[model samples]
Target: MREEELSPGEPAPRAREPVFLLPGSVSALAIILVLIQFASTMVLNPDGQNMLLYWFAFQPLRIVASLTDPSLALPLLWTPFTHAFLHGGWEHVLINVAWLVIFATPVARRYGTVGMLSLFLVSAAAGAAFFAATTLLEGVYLVGASGGIAGLTGAAIRFIFQPVLVAHHPETGERLVLGRRLASLREVFANPSSRYFTIVWLVLNAAVPLMPAVIGAQLGVAWQAHLGGFIAGFLLVPLFERRLA
Candidate 1:
């Protein structure tokens, strides 16, 4: 067939959208987490690592003590969010980072960098609050990004399973074919996949305290933090979507 010529006013076809998934902000956050883990494991001596935890990790006892002693209050303000950046070991951080990619990507794509960061920080802080409420008077330090990751996971569930949408840019006519509609609460619970997933997540986290006995090892999984973060993400994602709307 002979080549066809475009009309005088017709625009050329838009370029293919890139397939890259990791947004710059998400990659930056992931890199920061890995670097912190590397520093904890390789660069920091035992004493230095301990000091890092003391200053950054979330501890229920410290929060309680801060109520009476203002001198011990400085760390309390930051530890809630900072502890999500700290980890107990390589395995802990690695697992959290993996989940962060899986869960945070969808959220970052929908909400943009600012919304993703807001959800993460708020969830981390909420996790610390839950941990403190459960472990008050029990000297336990909470670390790792699982709580924040769980929040991302919960936020993702709001739209992850919806049908993908295909549209074109108004100006460029680009073949933009991604993203799903945010599901309503009724829709989420009505759908078997999401409902079952939520139930399973809740059950697993509820059983976190008993994990040591079941596995015969001390895993120190903070279930309360996970639940708190999940709840926050699940409830707050609509607000993010609304803001965008």
Candidate 2:
């Protein structure tokens, strides 16, 4: 069962909240990206210019530059929060949207909207840091919300492992405890239709790096970014999602 539509054993619904309190904060990120794409197209100069990185994008060098060069420092350095909203193309935006809708809703329901924002920002930074660290050895630019979505993937893994006691019925004092079952994650994985797709995801990730290495193609996947993002969420989600017995 999806998180929003809880099982028959779970708690009943509550009153409506404000609009900003969205179930998936990643949905907001997706909307922001659409705006960014439109703005980039309208404003981009074709004279071999890179305004996206210089002004709109998050520059890793800026952090180092801010530490050493006082002149390079801007008073308002809130670009990191904005960077994930900017993407290279429709493909980049669509992929993030797909990932967000698939996993982020459950994450936000468990942790709330602010917590979702934390996963996105921290995961993005973690991914960027990994990218930056690797570029020191071999230069490459990392773009897109794959890293943020990877964090959600990691969080989902942890969430699925919880011991959920689902009680049912009330008036006649009846309750059937599923009692620490695999109802949560199994609902998504224990399906014949999805088995092949899950295998392809893992296989593609494993094979992408080898493709570039084997074919002498300079381009390769950001395996490190995926790794970093996953680690961040796997480590951080428990801190945000705390429930008393």
TM-score of model number 2: 0.68
Q: Which residue runs does candidate 2 get wrong by more than 4 Å?
A: 1-24, 47-49, 61-70, 73-80, 137-140, 161-164, 168-208
Compose the digit string of candidate 1's lDDT tens values, residues 66-148.
78997787989899999999998888888898899888988998899999999998898888898889898998899989888
Q: Tens digits of per-residue lDDT for model 2 on 1-245?
A: 66666788898888887775446465676687777777776766754226565554555665556677876546216444455666777877787787887778777777778888789778877877766665643423456777777787667665554456767666766876543332233543564433444455556665666786688894546666676776687677767756533
Report every candidate's CA lDDT.
0.88, 0.65
What are the C-alpha RMSDs, in order, of all predicted structures?
Answer: 5.6, 8.8
| Cand. 1 TM to true fold | 0.84
